[model samples]
Target: MFTPHGPSLRELAVQALSSVERGYDLLAPKFDHTPFRTPDSILQAVERALSALGPFDHGLDLCCGTGAGMGVLRAVCRESVIGVDISAGMLTVGRDQEPRPAEPGPRVAWVRGDALALPFGPVFDLVVSFGAFGHFLPREFPELFGQVHSALRPGGRFAFPLPAPAPPSSPWYWALLGFDTAMRVRNAVWHPPFVMYYRAFRLGDVRRELERAGFDVELYALPEFGSRRDGSPRCRMVVATRRDDSSQRREASHSSLAAS
Candidate 1:
C-alpha cells in the first residue's frame, strides 16, 4: 500500500531484485511515502514512552532509514543524535529532511554503516530503531543486539516498539503469510537474495537475545492500540537497559565492609 509518490511497481521490482543495501538506496527518496516507513503514530507513541524514561544525553537511531526514529531521539535526547544506516542514499534524504527545532533541538548526524558492525563507542545514552528488523536474519539477532549493548554507556537504554501479530484467521495474517512464503520462494531461487523475513522476529526470541546480550529488558504497553482477544497487549514498547554490575557489586561490598 504505497502512495502516489511512492515507488512504482516496476521500481519495486527493480529494488526487490537488487541487494538490500542497493535496493534501499534506490528506494530512499520515496521511502517516507511508502508504508515501509515507520508510521507517525508509532513514532508519537515511542516519543511519549521515552518522555517518561528520559531526559537522555546522546541518542542513536540504529538502521535509521530516512531518520524517522531520529525524531523520537531529538524529542528526548538533549545533546546530539546520530542516525546510522547502510544506505548512503537514505542518509542523504535524512539529512535533507531534518527534525524540527524544539528547546535544545539535538544536533543530528548521519552515518552510513552496517548494523552488525556499528562504528561507535559506548557514548550514547539511548538507542532506538524502528521498522528495520525484517532486514536481519534470526542468527544476526545476537550480534546486532550485542553491538547495540556495546554502543550504549552504562545504564543507557535501547528501545523499540512492536505490534502484536494479527489473529491467525484474519485476512491480514494470511496476507503476511502469503507474502513471507513468496519471499521465501523468491530468495530460494534468486541470487544475492534480498533478506527480509517476517516470522523470524518473534518478541520472545528478541527478549531472550537482549537478555543474553546483557540488557535488562522490560515491556510497556502502548495503551493507544488497546488489547487482544486474550486480553494481552496489542502493542508493546521494549525498553532494554545496559546495566553496570561491577559498580553495583562494589557498592554492595563497601556496604558489607562498613556493616562489619
Candidate 2:
C-alpha cells in the first residue's frame, strides 16, 4: 500500500533482490512514502506511552532508518538523542529531513552503524527502535539483545512496539504467512539475501531472549489500537530495562560462597 510518490514496483523488485543494506539505500529517499516506514499514528502512540516512563538523559534509536523514532526520543529524553543505522543513504535522508522541535529539545545526531555490533558503550538511558526487526534473523536475537543491553546503562530501557499477530481466521494472517514463506524461498535461491520476514519475531521467544540478555522485560498495552477477539491488546510496547550488574554480581558472589 504505497502512495503515488512511493517507490514503484520495479524499484521494490530491485530492492527485494539486493542485499538488505543496498536495498534500504535504494529505497531510503522514498521510504517515508512507502508502507515500510513506521506509521505516524504508531509513532504518536509510542511517544505517549514512553513519555510517562522517561525524563532520560541520553537516548539512542537502534536501526533508526530515516529517524522516525527520533521524535519519540526527543519528547522523552532531556539531553541528547542519536539515531543509528547501517545505511549511509538512510542516514543522509534522515539528517536532511530531521525536524526541529518547537521548544528546546535534545540535540539530535545520526550515526551510521550496524545494530548487531552497535558502536556505543553503556551510556544511553533510553533506546527505541521502530519497525526494523525484520532485517534481523531469529538466530541473531541473542547478539541483537545483548548489543542493546550493552548500549544501555543500568536501569536504562530498550523500547519498541510489537503488534499482535493476526489470527488464523484473518486474511492478514495468511498474507503475512505467504510473504514470509516467499521471502524464505527467495533467500534460499538468491545471493546477498534480502531478509525481511513478517512472522518470525514471536513475543514468547523474544521475552525469553531479553531476560537471558540481562533485561527485565515488561509489556505495556497500547489501548489506542484497541483489543482483539480474545480481549488481548492489538498492539503493545515492549519495555526491556537493563538489570543492575552490581546486584547480579552480588547474587553470583553469594552463590559461589554457598558452594564453597
Model 2 clash pairs? none
lDDT of 1 by residue, 1-260 (tens): 37889999999999998899999989999999998888899999989999999899999999999988888998899999999999999999999998567555778899998999999999999999999898998999999999998899999999999999888988988888888888889899997799887767899999999998888999999988899989998999999999786876797899999999
Lowest-lDDT window of 10 residues in candidate 2?
A: 98-107
lDDT (tens digit, per residue) of candidate 2 on 82-143: 99999988999999998866888889999999999999999999999999898889999999
lDDT to native, each model: 0.91, 0.94
Poorly placed runs, candidate 1 (over 4 Å): 99-104, 245-260
RMSD of 2: 1.1
Q: Candidate 2: global Cα-lDDT?
A: 0.94
Strongest candidate by TM-score: 2
Clashing residue pairs for model 1 = none
TM-score of each: 0.93, 0.97
